[model samples]
Target: MSEPKRKNRENRQHGDRAAALNLFPLPPETEARLVIYADLLHKWQKTINLVAASTLPQLWTRHFADSLQVQAAMPAARIWADLGAGAGFPGLVTAIRLADVPGVEVHLIESDQRKCAFLREVSRETLAPAIVHQGRIEDILPELAAPIEAVSARALAPVPILLGYAENLLDKGAVGLFLKGEHLADELTDSAALGTFARYEFSSIPSVTSVSARLLVVKARAG
Candidate 1:
């Protein structure tokens, strides 16, 4: 890394730590695991296109914090499935956070073999209970043995198509929590018009990164 870029990463890390302490504090062990995961991600990014190059400087805040924030939405969830888990955003982060909890399992579904290899290495290194499923999201969902408590995707697809991929899981009693960018309103509007998720109540948590970003939480509607 260049001097300027290294300095920027350091500054961002410092800021993200401060913000995390105030808003998203983790247990000591969990914090340590995240440090390990971040280091591995940085090392991997040198050759592979894991995350976007532009966001590398703000990896802590933009990716880690953004991914970690979802824990608050489903505090008691034990089983999670992350669709299109490229580079293992929320999936790996969640697994690291819940590493100490018994029966906790995170399934990271990614189509790319290279990304799956990275996910497997991270899981092994961190000792996080993550199951890497190397296949299409559609193909993997049906093969899961049991219903997941939560399903998530980050920067994967539009709301409508995401819902389509997640429909089976949702019907099996899994709640959907997706990380969406600035155009959430437009996406939600477009999805609603498609008449999908009619029996669902959708809510959102504003991302810590910026006001334009949000974490959309979906659950079945009550009778």
Candidate 2:
């Protein structure tokens, strides 16, 4: 009988095949990294549940592609920060894609020490410009002397709670590029109720699944 791990690899390969069929026009380098990242996820998953069990096989489409969608949405971003970056979606992959670009940096923030350690390993292995900050977003925001051009989060939490953690730099001009699902309208309402923001736009997510996927870009009004 074959090892269970080998079976899981076979299943993961099947998932990668499905993701390849999607063809969302990712950069060549990014496409390569996606494959590597998928393998890494499968390996790390044995020790830690970084991603949802059901989505493991389809990591490419469910995670990488979903994150790459932001590329088209914000083509010329320079600096980026992924708040609550669990497993480096829209952050590590984002940085790897932009790795060659001069002066571009992507920061992946995570409060969990283990997650941060894992993120660091991936960053070093991939030579990505992502640095994992092992600290709470809320606690670190007030002290981050430098500012980032954009902020991102996926499956983090309500927009209000999201922005609350991002309040420091967000009060400045940094744009919020949050990955959201279909129920964005409801979250937007709740976010507004939390307090006022500047401007925001919602774009439908481009993915293989017909499900509701959207990117919410929010900006603060100029003072």
Candidate 3:
């Protein structure tokens, strides 16, 4: 393909993604905040490795849309903890989208000080109800004063480890919303073999953004 043709095709693809984002019920203010968030991400991504550089071209569909699906999975969750929230995918996005809702809080857990700073900046700029915790997941998750209603992690760890990381909150009734790619079946098998679930009920929700991706929802079953 010629250079100009390729460039035009790429631009059209980007435009299509931007249009696809409109399918969600995001408020206009939320959309504006996401634009600011995307700008900050691009600026900071230059110095630090926030996200995979290759995915930057499809930031709207690849990251933002993928994250938004998590919110769609559990719309009623007001209190959430996003583990390993690098560049704040679904966590920061959720906070931004739900900025209008009262009593909403999204805690973003990230150990990197620089990334935490970035998260803080976006939260401050967008007025998203996100609290950046610059510490390990194990240390910070256990000490949260507010009861987490949902726990989220994307491309962070395997199913077993994720369950272990959020076991404290999950045992206390918080649902776990994990974003997994094509290896979800294998992960679920491994999770079962490892006895990861003592009381949690696991269900898989298909992701609207990618066919290979899935939203794994873990909720504690009623006794």
Candidate 4:
């Protein structure tokens, strides 16, 4: 990298880190861990497609804060399953945030081996309470016996598809907390019209960081 470009990237990262701290305001230890996480992400991102290149400049608000808000929505959930845990949005972030708490476990389910490696590296370095599951979501969900209290995903799939992926856990009484975009209302309506999500009750809360985003909460209706 040229001198000017290298300096510019360093400056951008410093600014991004500052913004992350300002938005979240976590405990000192948690803040340190997230800093490390962000550093590793930036390093790995050079070779691996961990995040969108466009969003790289705003890693703090766009990715970290977005994931942190999901954690904020369900603070009491001790055991979590993050499906399609691409780049470990809410999953690894949840684990890091809850690492100090007792009995907190975040299951990160991803099919891609490379992403799993990345998740593992972050977990090991940050000592985050995450279990990286490197296999198909369908294949791994059945084997988990952690009594997960909640299941989460971000930019993974549509409502019905997510519910389908989480059906096993939902049937076992785990709540689903999915991060979604502005079109969530239409997605719900379309899924309802198709009766694809009849078994689950859906509700949404606005995202604290992004006006165009929402946190979709799902639970199975009683028989």
Q: What is the C-alpha RMSD of each candidate to the true structure, in Å?
A: 2.1, 3.1, 2.7, 1.9
lDDT tens digits, residues 1-223, model 4? 9999999988997888788778778999998898888889989999999999999888888888889988888889999999999898989999999999999999999998988999999999999999999898989999998998999999998887887789889989999999999889888888354665777888889887788999999998899
Report the C-alpha lDDT of model 2 over 1-223, residue by residue, as the tens digit: 4799899888876767556546566567766666677777788888998998998766777787777766546768878888888988878878877877888788788898878888888887777888778888876666555578788888898777777776655667777877877777787677445444434333444434326867777777665
- Give every collision pair in model 4: none
**Deviation from native of the Cα of residue 197 in model 4, angstroms:** 2.8
TM-score of decoy 2: 0.84
* True-vs-predicted CA distance for residue 141, candidate 2, Å: 2.3
RMSD of 2: 3.1
Q: What lDDT is obtained when candidate 2 is compared to the true structure?
A: 0.74
Q: What would the TM-score be for candidate 1 when compared with the true structure?
A: 0.92
> How do all the candidates rank in terms of lDDT, highest first?
4, 3, 1, 2
Give the worst 10-residue stretch by lDDT in candidate 4: 191-200
State each model's CA lDDT, in order. 0.87, 0.74, 0.89, 0.90
Superposition TM-score, candidate 3 onto the true structure: 0.92
RMSD of 3: 2.7
- Judging by lDDT against the true structure, name the best candidate: 4
Give the distance in Å from residue 178's predicted Cα in candidate 2 to where it truly belongs. Answer: 0.8
Off by over 4 Å in 4: 1-11, 191-194
Q: Each model's TM-score, in the order given?
A: 0.92, 0.84, 0.92, 0.92
- Clashing residue pairs, backbone N/CA/C < 3 A, model 1: none
